[model samples]
Target: MYKILEKEDIAPGEKLYVLDAPDIARKAKPGQFVIIIIDEKGERIPLTIADFNREKGTITIIVQEVGKSTMQLGNIKKGEGILNVVGPLGIPTHIEKYGTVVCVGGGVGIACIYPIARGMKEAGNRVISILGARTKDFIFWEDKIKTVSDEFYITTDDGSSGKKGFVSDQLKDIIDNKEKIDLVMTIGPAIMMKVVSETTRPFNIKTVVSLNSIMVDGTGMCGSCRVEVDGKTKFACVDGPDFDAHKVNFNLLNDRQKVYLKEEKEAHKKCRLEERISGNK
Candidate 1:
């Protein structure tokens, strides 16, 4: 059993858990993720490695309670033990001195992008970060990102704080100013990354996006996280959760996710029903 060292609600519907995984934390890297199951009968859920403390042997995971699995996870608290937590999976972010790099994050994806931005900074790259949310309350980690980034831009649709626009709007402004952006790493809603990639196409800027496609085993055999890049099939679990954004076909990916929605919802409902029935018996 993997013990939960700490857990807390960070934002509305978003919870953070720090687990006692000594081996995984020791080998964890900036862009990797983990596949966790709350119990033996629980469904597999993939979560980004939000943060890690190597010395302390802990890995942090930020989860948004969007579905049943996460709702169940939120019911638990610190010091509890998870049935299974396997990780340090997927390829780590390729770090190098890539000139000026723009790290983009949308909503809770900001947690995933923070480590990569910090790593880029350590590699002597000028890091510019662009973060956005539907509203200000949903945003988090401003100071952590800003500390590592040379330039930071924040955007929200409602303009409750930051600029009154989308993060894509900020990207256009940066390009308009003729700033040299060597690499762009984005993580967020699939559609948002699609727009970011489209925005940079005219300038031929190199952009990479992390795919959170449907994943089960989080190993190559499942083939659940397949993505089309450069007209070829690649598995996200083993091949990459990160790929060249310019070559990815977002339309296909969006369609696949929709196809499974109804079944996923039914599965979630079934799990909840069974738990309720057992509680009464």
Candidate 2:
């Protein structure tokens, strides 16, 4: 059992958990993820590795309370143990001195993009970061991301914070200004990533996106996380959670994400009802 070392409610529906997983932490890299099970009967869910402390043997995961499993995970306190924590999974982001790199994050994807931006800066790349959320309340890690970025911008759908626009808009501005962008890495909702990819495609900017497909197992055997990249099938679990944004079929990826929507809502509803009953008792 992997023990929870700490828990913090970072945003309205987002919780960050630091777990004691020495092996995984030792091997963890930016752009990889973990499959966690809250309990024996719990379903496996993949969460990107948000941060890691190698010396402390801990890995941090930021989760938004969007489904039954994540809600259950939020109820778990520090010192409690998780049934399973399988990871350091997926290919790590290719880090190099790729000149000026733009890292874009939307909503919870901000958490996923943090470490990668830091890594890029460390590799001597000029990191420009753009963070976005629906509102100010959903945003987190502004200071953390800023520390690594040479330049940073924030946007919100509502004018609650930063500019009243999307991350794609900010990116477009940077592109239009003729900034020399060597590579662009984005992690966010599929729609947001799609827009960012489209924004860069015309200029032929090297763009990468992290795909959050429907993944069952952390291995390729399950075939649940297969995505079409460059018109070829690739499994997100083993092949990558990262791929060339231009070559990815965003339509298929977005459609596949909806496969469990109805069942997910039902599960969340049942879990909520059970929690209320338990609270009453």
Candidate 3:
């Protein structure tokens, strides 16, 4: 059991939970994730390692309570324990001074992109970040991302904040106006990443995206998070959660994310009903 050392609400349905996980923290790298199982009977879910403090012996996981396990995990307190927190898993983000790099993130994906952008900045790269959410309230980590980014833009679908459009709009403008961007890194919904990749492809920029594959074990054994990259089968947990965007098969990844829709709905309903019944006292 890993103790929750600290917890902070970063945005609506999103939280930053710092756990006393020395080993994982010390070994963790940008773009990596942890497979969390709320309890023995719970299903495993992979969440990105938003940040870590090696000397402090903590790994920070920013989770959006969008499903049953996450909701269950969120209800627990700082002093509580997470049943399983296995990782620093998958290939870490490849950081180098790739000159000017654009990092795009959408919705809750901002948390995952934050660490990667920070690393890129430390590597002496000029990082530009674009983040978008459905509304202003949905976005988080503005100051944090700003800290590492040489340039930053925020967008909301409803025009409630920064730019009034999708993240791709800002990205398009950047690609059109900015000169000499060598790479682009993005993390979000499969469709969003696909669009971002397509946007950058026209500019002949190298684009990288992290795959949120349906994972059980944070290892190659399960084969649940398989993805076709450059026409070869790759397991996301070990081979990557990150891949060359142009080489990834997005249509399959989109379908794969929906494979457990029915089970997930039932699980959410079960959890809510259980909560209601227990609260009836």
Candidate 4:
């Protein structure tokens, strides 16, 4: 069992957990993830390693309560023990001095991209970051991201923050201005990553994106997080949570993600009903 050292509600329906995971923290890297089991009967869920402090022996994960399991995880507070926290799983990002690298993130995906951008900067690259959310209130960690980014831009779909468009729009402006981006990395909803991939493909910029497919086991034994890249089958758990965006089959991934929609809705409903019933006591 891993103790939750601290918990904070970073945004609506989103929470950040600082866990006492010394082993994982020591080995954790940017672009890797951890599979968490809230309790004995809990479902295993994969979450990106948002940040890690070797000295503190803690790893931070940002979770958005989008499903039943996630909602349950969100209810866990500081000092509670997470039943199982397994990993620093998957390959870490390939960091190199790629001159100028642009890191793009959207919604809760910003948490996934934060460490990658920091890694890029630390590797002697000028990191330009772009983050977006549905509205101003949905965004978090802008200051933290900017501290590591050479240039940072934020956007909102409703013009509630930095810009009145998508992160792609800001990216296009940078590309059009001939900023000479050597590499582009993005993490977000599949659709958003697909758009970023498409945007950079024209310029033949090497683009890497993290795939959030349905995952059961973190060890790739379940085969639930399968995805197609470059016309071949790849598992997101063991093979990657990150892949060449230009090569991934986003349409299939997007469709595959919806396979559990009905079940998820039902489960979420059940959780809500249980919450209300428990509250009434």
| Top-lDDT structure, candidate number | 2
Better of 1 and 3 by TM-score: 3
TM-score of candidate 3 against the unseen true structure? 0.97
Give every collision pair in model 1: none
Clashes of 2: 0
- Candidate 4: residue 15 Cα off by (Å): 0.6
Better of 2 and 3 by TM-score: 2
The model with the greater TM-score, 3 or 4, is: 4
- Top-down lDDT ranking: 2, 4, 1, 3
Give lDDT tens digits, candidate 1, residues 45-106: 99999999999999999999887788888878788888998888999999999999999999
- Tally clashes: model 3: 0
TM-score of 1: 0.96
For model 3, what is the alpha-carbon lDDT of residue 116? 93
Superposition error at 196 for model 3 (Å): 0.3
What lDDT does model 2 reach?
0.96
lDDT of 2 by residue, 147-259 (tens): 99999999999989999999999999999999999999999999999999999999999999999999998899989999999999999999899999999999999999999
Candidates 2 and 3 compared: the better one by lDDT is: 2
> What local distance difference test score does each model get?
0.91, 0.96, 0.90, 0.93
lDDT of 3 by residue, 1-281 (tens): 99998999888888889999999999999999988887888778789998899999998888889978989888888899989888879899999999998999998889899999999999999999999999998889899899999999999999999999888989899877867889999999888999998998877899999998899887799788999999999998899988999999999988998999999999999999998988831
Q: What's the lDDT of the predicted structure labeled candidate 1?
A: 0.91
